[model samples]
Target: MKTVPIQIALPEDEYADQLAFLKKWDDGPKPPGWELTPKAVVVFICGGSGLRLENNQRMDIAPKFIGDRSLVERCVVTLAGARGLLLVGEPGTAKSMLSELLSAAICGTSALTVQGSAGTTEDQLRYGWNYGMLLAEGPSEKALVPSPVLSAMRAGKVARIEEITRCQPEIQDSLVPVLSERRIAVPELGDYSVPAREGFCVIATANLRDRGVSEMSAALKRRFNFEHVDPIADKKAEVALVKSRTQRAIADAQALIDVDDAVVDTLVTIFKDLRSGITEEGWSVAKPTTVMSTAEAVAISTSISLAAAYFPDSGAQLALIPGHILGAVRKDDEKDTERIIAYFDKAIQRRANANPNSPWAILWDNRHGIS
Candidate 1:
């Protein structure tokens, strides 16, 4: 039987070449158990100009995270100092992606991860036991099953906690001792404890919108250096990111359609207007309750492209924008539908009237899709 490739590849596996090249490119001093120096790690995330290596070969490091270089530096510094790094941001601001890239760059792998959720338990953060082995061998090492955090501690690598706010407060507090003392006490085994190796640290992400679900305790909060990951502020940058991601997504689907830059620009404009509750022309618009993030823009762009690819007779790609926008906005609140309709009535209608040749005109023509 032929083995199939995974739909999504981990950062470590997907960027193995870049990692290896960085290791050889920068031989500067690295912190304990770190794969790349702090400078190289920053370059890996924020990107750098082409570098001429000692071997006369040129390599260009692509920017993975489109945000502040200083922010990435702070994240690296926090990890180097052996403190927990907490990334807080809106839902689609790429906080989790930043965490993965940081872990992959610092350690050799980004597989040590704990997905936080309402159903998450302390055992998933600390450790668990193999019931069959526990029944036979009692609380011996053979019976103990290490969690991702424990595995990272034992291996001297970085561990990631995704959506930490989604986890119960008590369950989230299980890391207090681990972060402060850098060790986990195994009460089941007398006098046995797992001490975090040199370079063992944690990176956690929490959505700002999920604050009320489970707030971190003061002790836990104090142990981590919080960094806010904001949305891409530059219009050109956001459009480029959306187009790049959309092309990648379309390629993943094995589709041959070319992504229309004009269509993507129009899509991103609508998202930005709806997200910020203001148009580029300084007109105020009603905002949707749901987040209109760059990630969602990419998704809608990819959907438009794929729809055009799979169904040639589905009209122009620009015509699909309004319906996709409606689908994206109406997720959380039903009132968002009225807000989107108002946006179409005011902003989109004005743009369509101003330029009949523009993509916005097509979106305006298809505005009925929202209703």
Candidate 2:
């Protein structure tokens, strides 16, 4: 019996077995380096709630995104069709997570990733020479160190470039031809080049908020089909996301912290108000410079739960919510505090009126006490 790869992040080991067992299956031909076809990639990631595995294991892979199912389907299709995919969104949107999931599901390895940063170099995008070996021996294939992108091409697998915009524009542009030509040319090595295998593709992510840092060149932009992953805005969706994420966080922490719905509601409300820069009633307020993302909300809520569990008497109530919200919002400007205060008074105060147990209200009452 063949064992499934252990590196796959899905809770299940053999997704193929899970797919077959879950009868809701119709898959196209698998690509050169992919375990499943484009269609199966969709079903695998989105999950099959009613499907069953061979050993009676249900396909319990929970849906990751709260957005349109069609968008996910489209992304999978785009990748399967060999088109380069670019997932652009604000900070904390699940672009990285989504890329990892897709890479794992399709190529059976999500480790082939290049993290974009200010110091990222062309060697990272293409291939780097083992400098010691290169100095000892002339420019030879033996001295060449293949980057994740090159390895992905040679292996016919998907390569992920995260925070593509964070890399300098020139460095980021190096991927344009690798995407369009689907090959990386190395004139120094020999009269040969690295030709991408049949299933090779690039999945890059960019942050809209980091637009000015290192913009993706127009040519590079033209090489990808962009998909913007937005934050989950609906209260119900946001609540579900936060609850699930918080639960996982607690589980990871090995702590028995139970976050009630009231707490979850308060956290979601604060995140939404601060993100949208307006009350639920459409009253406009000054917006903060910091990013109020769902990821941050999950993190903040998890912290609050741990605090409540460990120090129940520390007065971690609605009053504490503002401080947490303030820390998350006041990133680049002091003006954000005024906006946060306005939101607390207009939106949070009203919410507290409706729900007296709101943790944010405690923060509002003790606003002056917070630094």
Among these predictions, the greatest TM-score belongs to: 1
Best by lDDT: 1
Kindly provide the TM-score of model 1 when superposed on the true structure, using C-alpha atoms.
Answer: 0.98
Model 1 alpha-carbon miss at residue 149, Å: 0.4
lDDT of 1 by residue, 1-371 (tens): 99997998999899998889899899999999999999999998999888667997778988999989999999999999999999998889999899999999999888899999999999999999999988887899878899999999999999999999899988989999999999999999998999999889999999989864236888889999999999998999999999999999998999999999998888888888888888999999999999999999998999989999999999898888888988998899999999999999999899999999888888889988999
- The TM-scores, one per candidate, come to 0.98, 0.88
Candidate 1, after superposition: displacement of residue 95 in Å?
0.6
**lDDT (10s digit) by residue, model 2, range 85-188:** 99988889888888887887777777899999899999999998988988888799888889999999999988999988889999988888888888889889
